[model samples]
Target: MTTTTRTIPAIADQIVLVTGGARGLGRAITEAFLREGARVVIDYVTSADAAAEIVAAHPGRAVAVRGDVRDRAQVEALFAAGREAFGAPVTTVVNNALADFSFNGDARAKADEIDFPAFAGQFASAVQGALHTVQAALPGFDEAGSGRVINVGTNLFQYPVVPYHDYTAAKAALLSLTRTFSADLGPRGVTVNMVSGGLLRTTDASAATPDAVFDAIAAGTPLLSVTTPAEFADAILFFASPWSRAITGQNLVVDGGLVKD
Candidate 1:
């Protein structure tokens, strides 16, 4: 079978805000937007050096800002900083910031060991963070007459191969918010969607994952290879471009066919 890829036009005119964009998948997403000619604000809490490096590499195209997405006040400041730097309100927001946690499935807490606070923290970062960003960006969206929100998610919510209960649960809730937000913002010309990825081969969060796990996951996938941060980041651009104007309230899994859904 022959498959052709469609090129998405550069979103140079749009100012983008990416939470947790200093490192890991977030960094990749930030760079991807920059390469597409978009001005990007890299929001980070502790990865200041890494964020600075990204800004230095991209020069005028990217700026790094420190903010905690779980805090509404900080989220507002994040948007404000983006506008001040780029002289325009952020037209696109990617909720890619995750709660500080490693992806070592073997060390993860099982159902019995997990508690309410665990779930609460995850929800705070996954759901509340998105909420704060979307709320902060509403005015801008209203001004622009359109907006795009791409929520970063995971395939574990579907396959649960590692049973990362808290992480997966939080991501599932994020997916729910993505759809609900689409419904509420659709009439306003705003679109909300999710890009779910499986166990990425390597990232700060996934660095602790054993090599055996990666091999197993790759063997199960039809592509016989793990997905890269760059590949997953590319899928996120689709939702922010004109090509996806008609698409919303949907989840696109980019795990190299590890999970069919």
Candidate 2:
């Protein structure tokens, strides 16, 4: 059977929204979209200063709005702020907000030490946060007649080398949502997908990781270097670009060949 899809707007014409866009990988994703001439709406729970800096740097192209993605009302307000900024609703969304987490393995609770509450906390942000954003963006997506939803994920689900029990489990659930959402929304002119990255060389989240851990990950990768937030951001742009119009429900791993899928 053949499937039909709507024509996605060019990046220049798209108004983009990035959750947690003030720092780390989210910042890079926001910048990448802006560089492609897309008007960007940056969502931040904290990091107001960083968000302001980005807005100042980009001038008219970017605006930062504060919101907690886990709260459905806040998420809807976040989109409303975006609509007010650019005179149009967001046509593309990157669900990149993460609950507070640090990548230092030594500090992480061991699987046995971690509890259900830990898992629940992560799910509240990663899974539910994404759900809220998608639901909030639906009306906008319907208005535009085309949309792109790219959920940030992790390579750990495939390899589970470090087994960050709570964090990894939450991301695993997010990947499932990415596919299911794609199926339900594809015909309606929305494409949902995921971009999973390995241990990024450096980000506020990974700063706590020791240098040795970074070195080891680099050595293991075919590229002989750990991926950077900027590198991963490029792949995120692909899913939102015109090139990815017909592709959905798939996860593209962007970890420099660390995990083959």
Candidate 3:
């Protein structure tokens, strides 16, 4: 299968599903995909009003669906719902939704105090959701012979900062899943990859973090700056585009040099 140029022929018509796309970096990813000419499905566990507003802005270009990633049935149904609205065999998926992320704040407990339950909670969101999602989308990909999964992971697993063990573990697991899926799906032409980032300034997910903390992070990066959602989204788009057809089972870090590969 040959990939098209910067703008693929069917790419604009692609049905791109993004989990947790109602707000934050996910929202930016959704908007960017829509702007790039793909029909987008914005999946959210909550944030109904925010999702509605986003869909309203995009009209035919977007649709919002709600389902908990922790539940397998819900995850399957979420993909089904997306397919029912935009037709089956979605060309791409962006696994940007995460749980237990609201606690990455200065006021939150330190790494030593975090419990195992909290750690499990984080994986329940990504691992469970991603597994079901890939399962649900498998047949479609097999039929199409070409599909993409852009897993949104974090750089913390590579560069730990005081051990937010749970979040880091989930991301690390996600990276592993990416590699395995890439190999498993390669024969059928399905590409699986990850785009991870360091701490970001704004987003419902990052609201708990303090501004001063982010400033410190920005100072610590080799680039001496923070990466924006737009920059992160660009990396995601690269994986979806034909340019990255040869790349798979890889993690693209977009943290302004905070974590180098």
Q: State in Å the error of residue 16, model 1.
A: 0.6
User: What's each prediction's TM-score?
Assistant: 0.95, 0.97, 0.91
- List, residue by residue over 182-223, the lDDT tens digit for candidate 2: 999988899999999999978999999899988988888899
Give the TM-score ranking, best first. 2, 1, 3
Highest lDDT: give the candidate number: 2
Point out the worst 10-residue segment of candidate 3 by lDDT.
Answer: 3-12
Total residue pair clashes for candidate 2: 0
Q: Positional deviation of 47 in candidate 2, in angstroms?
A: 0.3
lDDT of 1 by residue, 50-160 (tens): 999999998888989899999999999998898889888899999999988999877889888889899899999999999999999999988777889999999998898
Candidate 3 backbone overlaps, count? 0
What lDDT does each candidate get? 0.91, 0.93, 0.82
RMSD of 2: 1.2
Identify the leading candidate in terms of TM-score: 2
Error of 3 at 46 (Å): 1.1
* Superposed model 3: Cα runs more than 4 Å off: 1-10, 103-105
